[model samples]
Target: MTGNARLDLAIFDAVDIDTVGAFYAGLTGWDIVRKDGERFGLRTPEGQEIEFQRAPDHVPPRWPGQEFPQQFHLDLETDDPQAQVERAIRLGATRLADGPAWITMADPAGHPFDLCQADGVGPVMRLFAVTVDAPDASELARFYADLTGMRLVHDHPEGALITDGERNLMFQRVDDYNPPRWPDPAYPQQAHLDLVVDDLVTAQARALELGARRLSAGGERYRVFTDPADHPFCLVW
Candidate 1:
């Protein structure tokens, strides 16, 4: 929390928890470590975890929609993009498009993810980055860099990337992006990050200094706040 904060989770809010959990577990060969009626969690071989929570009345975001946009997307790394795309399709993912360096696809719950070809990184599918949509990529990246003390690796008009060595976070420029209304299902939070910190009060103060707006002060070990781009994230001890 003081020196380097770790990303604990990349969570998705899905209509069917089991379906989404199964899709990611099969897609990544990760173990579904936690499962209940309301929540399903997967622990990757590398120890990374992604979870999906039940939202019966969830309305999936429409891609390229200004009204209800995809707030974020997961970037998966693979040595063979084509084979991974095929495998994803077999596991209930819908191929959206294939870019020159990445293939865009949606999971069973209609959340978009990218399968990017890696340069001899590994054959196993791995979560590379969690890209968040923002009004200004560079600005958002700077905010996170200050908050986490991470380096700003990439800076561009289209997008900007930041990393804390262990995890990568990207910010993509989105025109007329609408910030999600916290606790309001109308503007649902499609995805969110859980950052681990040491002290709540000290970390919260540092976060606010870095432009994080406190949304809620609930829970004994966690608090909810919105980033400069209005993406909700939790600071947990």
Candidate 2:
């Protein structure tokens, strides 16, 4: 199937944009492309952008638990996990867990991410995937696959993966996932995805037909909608 939208940006809500933005920039070696009083944007070597928006009253997620669940986390591939972990720690990341193949750490804003050991000799580090939590990984994966027209690369009961070769989107099974209530600061959306489309009207209609719920929040150039799993995403023209 053809993709209705192209993944453009991944945005995170942080209490302090400077701290969070600087931490990610130091870790990923990405340059700050856009910076303002309340918002900061960093662009990867490949031009993929990760933005952080200031949310003074942002409520951080509690990972490894259902209470204030983490809506999403980034997986970064690194050649030397130990070195990267050390660097991350120095950059204000707190070590959360350790595994043979991956090391989990929480960023300055309390978002958990993994420093996964890469297989071959490549760049020192690169973004591996953007993973979201769901009650049913298989079902959510299918929904995103159909919505983004990405190929399902891995499917299992616990997790699922969809990719367009370079970039990947993953779904992990959470026992009791607590979705975000957007437009409500009490239960904030920690992070969200922005998808670009050629035609906003057609794309919004298609998204709604594919089990997406229209949200009341949006602007002229874009419209907001929540996926089947209730994570906020935008269709931008």
Candidate 3:
């Protein structure tokens, strides 16, 4: 790899990786590239892949569930969302909201996602934009932008949006973002985001200063931390 990772994915965790992977594989015609019990990789027709990890304490999000809000979601490119929703409904996905241009929905695992039309060309295709959930929209955006050398690309009702080179992330605001259930609820988020940082140590420090909870510390080159929403993110070398 040159400097940054080649691609990014807006992932959703599931209790059963096979069940979840089957749903998506059927939808996109993607096949499994690698499966090692806990982790799976689904490759698109063009060779792009999406990974899903089997979580130990994976809790299927309850859409209108107070404790589990829609944090990160996938955006699929489909010509007709209505048609896709109809089909997905039969396959265990539910419609959260639908409009002419876009439709927000949930997978069988209760993870949120969206389906929209693609508006790009050739190999430079734009899939779904990643949403970064936060309580203090402005603060989180600034922290992430400063840490990643990215720019505040835009703003929205829930929160702000930012992009670093090819990486596009949306910040959505949530009320009372009490992190993960942790050792108590046994519903630790099985999924996490891998963020490339300039300096893993410095980035970890900065994140901690911003209320990020350190999950594990030590010999590994990366550090894991929980966001205000209880979702885990990694500071990768």
Report every candidate's CA lDDT. Answer: 0.84, 0.85, 0.65
Per-residue lDDT of candidate 1, residues 69-108 (tens digit): 8898989888888988889999999988879999999999
Considering lDDT, which of the candidate structures 1 and 2 is the better prediction for this target?
2
Per TM-score, what order, best first?
A: 2, 1, 3
For each predicted model, how many residue pairs clash, with residues at least 3 apart or on different chains?
0, 0, 1
Clashes of 1: 0
User: 112 in model 2: Cα distance from truth in Å?
Assistant: 0.8
Rank the models by lDDT, top first. 2, 1, 3
TM-score of each candidate structure, all chains considered together: 0.92, 0.94, 0.76
lDDT of 2 by residue, 1-237 (tens): 354687888899899999999998889887899889888998876666789989888888777777787789988888889888889999999999998899999999999999999876365357888888888898888887877788899999699999877568899998877888887777689899998888888888788888899999889999999988888999888
lDDT of 3 at 17: 78
Best by TM-score: 2
Clashing pairs in 1: none
Q: Write the per-residue lDDT of candidate 3 for residues 123-207, one digit (tens) a residue.
A: 2223445666567776666656665566788765578876765566677777766445544455555355766655766777777
